[model samples]
Target chain A: MLKKSGTTLIEIMIALFVLASAMIPIASIMGYGGRATSKDARRILAMQLLDKTLRQMLQADYDEIPIGKNIQNGFEGIALGDVTAGQDKGFSFNISLDSEYVNPVKFKYRGVGVNRPTFKADSPVGDDFLPEETISLNDVVIKLTVTVTWNEQQNLPVSVSAMTYRADFQRRTG
Target chain B: MHYLDAKRSGMALIIVLTLATGILILGISYINTIRKQSGRNTIELGAIQADLLAEGLTQIAMLKFKEIPGPLYYAYIAHVKGNTSQPYSVYHGDAILGGKLDSPFNAEFRTTFQLLSSKMYQDMNVKITVEVEVSRPDGEKYQRLIERTVSGSRRPAF
Candidate 1:
């Protein structure tokens, strides 16, 4: 008579092992994908924040632009929109300005000058001709930098920055 | 009995191999898709940066014109009149192009200036073209051109 034989314990265990090994990589990939999506979302928000802040800085009057570095925490609610219950949360931004001189060649010949008010006789009389090769206060090049920083899930610090130059054009008038 | 047992084990081995191969393919495909998506994001970010930087450079060019209106006007006029030897005749070369600005990624800029008009009783308009090229995080390069025209509020006295 013919008899049916059941699979042994070793065969079942080997099959399970093979399946689990294959699944391990898939599970890890899924985890990595989730984290990557979160990071990308945060990066998008950071880029938007940076763009807005940089536009504001560029639009401001050159003289009125705050010089040196300034940092703002909870910048999202302040710069972006209102937060829940007046809570300041999310990324921080740092803006800085560094100025340098852009020397323009001075001409010996003087053109129209601003009329000066009469001074007291005690004051020393300055030269009628403007000093040659003198740089004006407006002849300056300013480097403006805006950076946004945030901490990721593992408390991993992530930051991005954008910088551009702002020359003191002295173009704006009262 | 031995033949039957061997046949059953062979069937089990085939099933396991098929399952493993299917899963391995799926994993590789998923990883490739993710990599492509990440690369696209990097390109998008690089393009945005290049455009913004170009805009900023345009503004800087406008400001530079405003700051040195007299010299720039003189230079333009000298160029038109074929007087290259005069002081402030040159458009000051690329001195206005502030070179590379600091950023998380690499960026470079090139600028060109055109004196649009110098007619009588009209505003002197200067057209500035700013070309900003940025290298993406994914080893790709992006370029953007921003053009702006700024008019002098008042004619510069040269």
Candidate 2:
């Protein structure tokens, strides 16, 4: 009589257990990949929105810059789109104008006004930006920021910011 | 004895099949995630390009003003040459290169400009128009519009 050398119940059970264990890591990798993709997409949108708003400001007229023109806080409120409350987008922006004497910025805040490519102090201002200095003129401060929020539960919002100011000085024309 | 082994072999086959099914489901979900990500990239690229074009539009408007620059309706319109404008297409949103996306957004500006002289400062209200036609690499088209009014004065500020 010819007898077959087939496996028993215990042996087959052991093989399956090993196979499932081996597949665990592969399943985890797939799960991680999905979350990473969503994160990347949101980040890209934030960058684009921020760039769009900033470009508009840059293209504005030299005089149109946010200097003493925060009239009725309109320029300050121009940071976000809609006029009143309940018109909130995913972001909001504001600009404020006051004598550097009221609240001295830059010269001490960010250490700007000295970096290269610095304008030769041509345009005129009201109060002296660097109070310690002699010239007294108006200083324009521009504060820009973009905040992005997802509609998901408890998801933290992301933001990008830009801060720069125009100093007081008259550029002697040729 | 042969019957007992045959049943054990069948049980193992079923277990293996079940695992394969789980793997397929996971694979499909992962692919969906990637596609969603690609769609977002398209919007971001479109937004940046649109803003750049808008800046150009603003500068052009400032250079040339209408006799009666209505601060309400001055802006630009960007669209594909062959096809009319549509809203959003995930496929076509690349405005970085000078491709079809750039072609549709031709510059159409106002002719007359307000001239401000010294002594008499007038409230100059001008309308500037800017349109961004988003062209994506994957053969899609999109457009965005911006309407702005600019008020200019003659005298130097205080």
TM-score for chain A, candidates 1 onward in order: 0.58, 0.46
Q: Score candidate 1 by DockQ.
A: 0.27
What digit string (tens of lDDT, one per residue) describes model 2 on residues A1-174?
122335444556665775676577667767667566645645554554446445545534434554332222334223443222112444333322221111222210111132335322222121212222111122232322233333222555443332212222112112
Candidate 2 regions exceeding 4 Å error are A1-28, A31-174, B1-9, B66-124, B152-158
Residue ranges of candidate 1 with Cα displaced over 4 Å: A1-3, A8-13, A73-141, A168-174, B1-9, B70-89, B92-105, B136-139, B153-158
Clashing pairs in 1: none
The DockQ-based CAPRI class assigned to model 1 is acceptable
Q: Write the per-residue lDDT of candidate 1 for residues A62-159, one digit (tens) a residue.
A: 66554555434323223422222112445443333333333552212222122445422122123221332323344455666666666677777776
- Reported per model, the fraction of native interface contacts reproduced equals 0.31, 0.06
Q: Give residue A101's error in model 2 in angstroms.
A: 36
Give one digit per residue, the lDDT tens place, for model 1 in B89-144: 23334444635644456877887666776542345688888988898655799989
User: Second chain only: TM-score per model?
Assistant: 0.69, 0.54
Best by lDDT: 1
**What lDDT score belongs to each candidate, Candidate 1 first?**
0.59, 0.39
